[model samples]
Structure formats: C-alpha cells, structure tokens
Target: MRGSIRFGEFLIFLGALFLFWQYAPWDIFSALDRADLIIAGGIGLLICFLLALVSRWFALDELIHIVALVIGAGLISLSHDVIHTANWSWGDFSFIDCSGGPFSQERDDTYTHALSANAANPNIQVQVLNGRVDVETANRPDYEVRIHTCVRGWDFDHLKEVLDQTYPKPELREDGFSFIQAKPSRGFGMSANVEIILPQSASYKVSIDSSNGRLLLENLSATDLNLSTMNGSITLTHVAAQSVKLHSTNGSLKGQLSAASLAATTTNGGVHLELTPTASGRYDVRTTNGGIELDLATQAIGYAVAADNTNGRIRVNLPQFTTQGQSRNHLSGQTANFAAASIQVSLTVHTTNGSIEIRPQ
Candidate 1:
C-alpha cells in the first residue's frame, strides 16, 4: 500500500507539472499586469493544492475541502455566461467550436464608412486586438474604411450581439478620423480585419496598433507613420514618409521605404528593408533572434554603415565602403570620399542570433 501510494503521488505530481508547463500564462506575467498576475498565481496554487490532496501527499481538513469546493463553484457560476467560446491554444490543447452545440457556429459581419479629409494633412488612427489590417492609397475621390469581423462559437447569436455592442463605429474627431475597437467582448472568439483606403492626392499621418494581426500598407504617402503589433507580421511597399517606425514582438517586417528617418525592431522575426534614404537621415534596424536583409537604392554615397550579429555571418556588398572591423560577426565602415559631404546617412543593423546581409539595390 505504501509503494502504491508513492507511485500514485509521483504520477499526480508529473501530471500537475505537465499541466502547469503547458498552460503557464507567460505573456500575462511578462506584461507585468499585477492584477492578472495575482489572479493567475492564485488559480495555479489552488490547482496544485487540489492535486496534492488528491494524491494523498497533503492532508487537508474536511472543512478546507468544503470551502475550496464552495469557492470553485462560485467561480464557475460567475464565469458560466462568459465561457461561451474561446480560441485558445496551449501545447496540445486547442479549443475549437465544432461541438455542434448552440454556441458552435461561426458568424461573419462587415461594417464600412466613408470619411472626408477635412484637413490638408489628416490624421488616422486604428487599434485592433486580432486579425489583419490592410491600408492602401487609391485614386478615389473619397476616403473609406471597412471592417470585416469574424466570430466563432457555439453561441453565434450571443457572439454577434456582443460584437455589435463592443465594436466601435467610425467617428470623425476634431483632429482626424478614428476607427478603433473601443471595447472588447468578454470570452468570444472573434477577429476584425480592417481595410482602409485613402486618397492618393492627400498626405496623412497614420498610426496603427494591433495586438495580434498582420499589417500591410501599400502605395502610401504619409508625413508620419507608426505601426506596431505584438505577434503579427508587417509588410510595407512603396511607402514614403518623413518619419516611420515599425515594431513587432514576434513577427517579421518587410518594407520598401522612401523615408527620411526609419526605425524597425523585432524580438523573434526577420527584417527586410529596401530603403531609398534621404540626404541626411538615420535607418536603424534590429532583431533579437532573426536575420536582416537590407537593400539600399542609391550607392553608398556619404553613408556610414554598421552591421553586427552575435552568432551568424555579416555580409556587406557595398564596394566603396571599406570594412574597418571585418569579422564573422561585425562590420563597420564609412563610404570612401564621403568626408566632405554636406549631408550624410547613417545605417545601423544588428541581430543577436541571425545573419546580416546588406547590398545595393
């Protein structure tokens, strides 16, 4: 009996560890949200304690078990209506709406609105939690934005209702036009894909923030542009801006930019930049664990180039730029005969665990 109990405890401990490792809320804790961290920790502790009790490794009084049961029941009751459907994946567990229940269907809805650019240089801002965003400049007479929303669940009607209540409409503000997701639903599996069409004749300042969505911008002429996402890729083509900033936590960045000043960074994704730099400007590109491929449109005229990688090769294809610290991991030099230039360009690219490739377009 003693041996059997020990074996059972070992199995229980292994199971508990597996579950914990599988479902650990690393992103939440890393975000440093105190309330969410506390709640997650409490729930984890409770699960462990209950598993210990089941394995007979910890002796708990009957009153303690009763109180725990009461608390658990209360939590379940509170979350009953909120647990309709969720698109959550952890390790080998993926929750999908295929149970054919009342809440297992998928629904899609679209909303669109037109805005008139009141100012000479209007400002546009967009915020989305999930899905894709595509922005393009068109030769249209009017500016328009469209939202395509997809919600999946067993309770399709409820999800649709929640989306109708939570999704924000396009509002014309004093400074510009805003099309943002102001409120999010409690526990619905939903994604909103946005498409914005801007007038080609007008220059605008645009800012977009997405938590988990791919962003694509094409043929845009903006005074200032800022795009960022936590876990989604960004692609830009034929974009001209005075100042541009792009960032992603775990996604790639690809841009063909004609910007005066540009900066791009990613934690776990590659960066590909094809830049037509200004006379005097800075282009900074960095990634923690991904490669960088850069193509400069003009010759290395009055340009100071620096590229570095911790655990990968560094290749520079500019002939006039003599490498000073040429090694397997680092390269830095200035273009020859660039000392007397009135304006200069500085390009810096770095990656911790990937390659750096720089060449002329």
Candidate 2:
C-alpha cells in the first residue's frame, strides 16, 4: 500500500511538471527578477510551510486537504488572470472578489481625443493590456481617437479607479500620438476597446502592440504599418500600405491587403491572405499549428510561389505555374512566364501541423 501511494505521488509530480512546462508563462522569470514578486513569493512560501507544519503536528489530514484545495483554487484564479494580463506580479495574488467568472462585473466608459493633422502626415501608436482595437477612416477629414473601456467583475469602484489611473489620457507627440498602460489593476477583470479614425484624404503610419485582444484595421492607407498581439485574432480589410507586418502568438489572422511588401506570422492559428492582381511585392506567411489559405488574383502578371507543411497536405490551384518537388507535404512552383517575368510577386507560405491551400481569386 505504501509503495502504491508513493507511485501515485510520483505520477502527480510528473503531471505537475508537464503542466508547468506547457502552460506557465516563460515571462514569469522577468517578474521574478523584480523585487516585488520575489518578496511576495518568499512570504507566501513561509506561510504555506508554517501551515503545513501545524497541520502535521496536529495530525489533521482534513485540514491539510482543505488547505490544498484552497491553494489549488487560488492557482486556478491566477492562471485565468495571467491569460488577460501576461505580467505576473504581487498584485495578481490579491484575492479577486468576483462571484461569477472572471469577467462578470459590468462597467463602461468612453473617451475621445482629437489630433490636428497639418500638412505633414501624422503617425499613431497604441498599446493595450487587454481588449479589441479597431482602426478605420473617419467619415469626415479629421483625425480623432476614441477609447471604450468595459469592466466586468464584482468590484466596480476598483475597476473604475484602475482604469482612470492606468490610462489617464493620450500623450500627443510631434510626429504621432501614443497611449500606454502604466500598471495593471488588482482583483478585477476589464478590457478597453480603441477606435482610431483617420482623415480620409491623408495617409498616415500606425503601430499597435497588445497583450490580449482582437485587432481590426479597415479602410486605411499608411506608409508603414505594424500590428502585434500575444493572444488575439487580427482582421484587415481594404488596407493599403507601403510595408506591412503582422504577428500573433495564439490567434488567427485574416486580411485583404494592398501593400508593396507584407509579412504575417502566427504560432497557433490559421492565416488567410487575399491579394489583388496589381499587388506586386514580397509576401510571406507562416504558422506553426494551423492551416493557411492564399487567394491570388487570376490576372496576376507574374508569380513565384512556395508552400510547405510538415504533417498535412498541400494544394495549389494556380495554373500558370509548373509544380516541382510536389508531395503531400511540400510544393514549389513559379509562374509560366518565369523566364520573361516583368512584374513579379514572390509568395511563401509554411505551416508545421496543417494544410496549405493556394487558389486564384
């Protein structure tokens, strides 16, 4: 009986290690380097040790089990919090007072700011800890940015206070505008949705960095554009740029882009790209664990295409190119006019665990 119990404990220990390696955020090391989290961890460990010692002395197995249950519950809560706020700190250890799920409280607020677009084309940069971001052209030829904050939890006052303190106002600079969150709130769930309305007649540059949220860009013309997120989907429609780059860690990306050069990459989601015939530039898309769908204009002047998948099939629907190195997992081809190509577009798509589909629009 004792040997069986020991074996069960060993299996549990191995399972815990596997879960930590798979889901625990690697960025927690950065937090540990800080004094705050280190101090919090030290205090927590001391308390847990003392409680265990007391339970053992009193032979209170039930008490020990109760304490273990509480710790498990706390860890579950912390994991959910980490999904939204990737940064782990002492604040996250605070007990969340919400009765229901993480996002249960309800609160909403709107903020608006205007920018004076002179003769020079303006630039905009936004960073958010959580929530969706939408950028679109304004109906009028004016520059404005709007933010809608939504909070759902048991604590309303705490959420409001955090929102007001973290994001006071937009800081306007000479070349562009920026909105950054300084710190995260304790014991609450919230999200902020941002909308940037640019002048229809003017072209600008935009960059967005988000920790967790969907991003939507529509009907915007920019000289250079960059979009990145840790845990959210991305959608682009009617976007025109000279150079565009997009990245997501754990979400899908779908876009119809008109750009001189474009690159899109994701770790665990699919990618879909739709290009125009006149879109002549270098295009690259890659994902680790999801499929890829590429739609190219049938009347494209010239083309160079390559696609690969490690554990899935590959399909190409373009007739102009003669396929070589064709297999269930790899494809390489070029346009029929490869020798006399005039306006050429280079395309590359790769995925590790899913199919790759290329078709003409």
Candidate 3:
C-alpha cells in the first residue's frame, strides 16, 4: 500500500523465488544441504528481520503488517521443497550446474537399444532436459539408440534414481521414434547423453532438443532437421539435410554442414562452419558473443551475402565477391551473376562481439 511493492507482496515474491530455485533454508547457498524444517525457520526469521526495517523506512507499514508478511513467508518456505538456488536465471544468466544439484561425484554408463523403425518416413526426435544428444547415421538396416547418463548424487542409490529419471523413453510408431527425458528427477542431480543411429530413409528427419548439454550430429541425411539446446555447443559432421535449423543459448556452433537451407543462432558463443559446396544453398548464422567464420570452397560458386559484426572487423576473402557496401564491421554485396548456373548461394552472418570472416575454401 505504501509503494509499488507492499511488505507482504515482496515477501511473497521472495518466497516464490526461493521455491523456484529449490533453495531450502539450510541449503541457502549450498547445493547439498536439505534440512527443510530446521532451516526454513531460520530463513523465515531472517526474512522477517531483514524486511521489517525496510518496510518501516519505506512503506512505514504497521507492526501487524510486518508480522503477517513474515508468517506468510515462513509458511510458504515450509510448504515447499525449497527450490531456491542462488542463481536465478534472469537475462542470460544460469547456474554452473544446470541440473540443480548435489554436486557430488560424476559417473556415466552406456547401453544400446534397438528401436522400431518406420518403413517410410523414419524420424528421430530426442528431447533431453539436462544432457547431450548425439545422432549419427549407420549402414545398418535397423534403428538403434545409445544412452550415457552422467550426474552427481548424494550416494549410489540417489545417483541411480537421478539417472533413471534422466533416461529417455523412446517410443516408436508408424510416424517415427520420439523420446523425451523427464525433467531432472525431483530431489537429485540429473543429466543424460543420447546417441541415436539408424539407416537412411528417403524422408528421414532428426529433431533434438536439450536443456543443458552439448550436441553432436554426424553423418545423417534428413528432409528436415532441427537441433536446439538451451546451453551447450553444437557440432555437425558430414550432415546432409535439405533443411536445417540449429540454435543454442550459450554455446558455439562448429563443424561441417551441408544443406540446401541452413539457419543457426547462438548466444555467448561463436559460429564456425565449413560448408560443403552445394549448387544452390541458403545459410544464415548469427551469434551474440562470439566470432563467425564461414568457408565455402568452390571455384565455380557464386554467392550473395550480408555480413555484420557490431564490435569487430568483417572480412570477405572470396575472389569473386564484389563489395557494394563496406565498413569496419559490415559488408553487403554479391559475386557477379556470371557465376556458373550450377552454384548459387546466399548467406547472412552476424555477430555482436567478434569478427566475421568469409573465406573461399
């Protein structure tokens, strides 16, 4: 009532944040502490004392108001799992251990499972909430998947529980195979890596989404491929796809990529790609905190590009590229139309804090 944030309101918001971050009282800062009731009492009292003076000075709320706010905050903390962590993601910030954690020893075990495949459009869709995803193409006639789960826990049993929850459940149907790992198990650390292998099909598709681990995609041909992760690097090797989309929140994009159309974006990471020469192709790659390197080697290739970098230099080294507009960090132009009718490429690459280089392979 005194200002925008009432005494009780602020306390409520704080309580909610604590719950969201899984920060119990005892584990206020430690990722391993979990004595709920005991710590919740101290936390509630601290909140009460800390906010009382502020409310008195700013809001000048009544004594009853301060008391009520503290009581409510305490209740909230006591009723929750105390999902409060110091690192509450706000604008490109995240915890070091993506899987809110015990931070104990790390272990990983690998196993292979044969999957059901569709005769027509065999697709693989993997969603790992807190681990890496790798996919490769094999000459085998069947579908197979390998899982490697790694994470920290209080003990062997706790670790097993976390790993069990992180394992992906792949379901196969006439359409394709889909697997989604449940959110990191409730009370322990959780992370898992997945590797999928399958024979090529006429219309195979690969879609992988990960919350907090690197992704490696190799030797796969698909009509459409979409790979994304909240915070990890992405690598593509000998990948052949008609259409591809790659994204990351805090990692780089690297490796060889071949596609008719490709779009990649990242934050806090660089984009380095060696694109296989294709007659006709469209590519767009951008990053916020890293450099962009693109190389296309083809004597007969003709390309039109618009490259921009906010805080670094831009260089275009293609002999055939004629610069129409140039600056320290921006370039836009295209090679003469005389390029052989066979090779035509259009590219857009941009970065905020790194240089942009386009060299002929």
Compute the lDDT of residue 342 as modeled in candidate 1.
59
Worst 10 residues of 1 by lDDT: 92-101
- For residue 133, model 2's alpha carbon misses the true position, in angstroms, by 0.3
- TM-score on alpha carbons, each prediction: 0.71, 0.72, 0.68
- Candidate 2 lands at a TM-score of 0.72
* For model 2, the run of ten residues with the poorest summed lDDT: 91-100
- List model 2 lDDT by residue over 1-361, tens digit each: 7566557655654565445433444333322233344455456656766778766454364345344444444454445445434422231121112121234433444444454656465778888766667888866744666766545444545655655655535676545578774434433445566777776777778889875667888898888889998667788898888888999987788878877787889987899888763446788889989999988775635678888889988888886778866777778888797556555788888999999989887
- Model 2 RMSD vs true structure: 9.5
- Candidates ranked by TM-score, best first? 2, 1, 3
* TM-score preference between candidates 1 and 3, better one: 1
Clash number for candidate 2: 2
lDDT of every model, 2 decimals = 0.68, 0.67, 0.68
Clashing pairs in 1: 102-154, 103-153, 103-154, 103-155, 104-153, 104-154
Which residue pairs of candidate 2 clash? 105-152, 105-153
Model 2 residue runs over 4 Å out of place are 1-71, 82-119, 150-160, 173-175, 185-190, 277-280
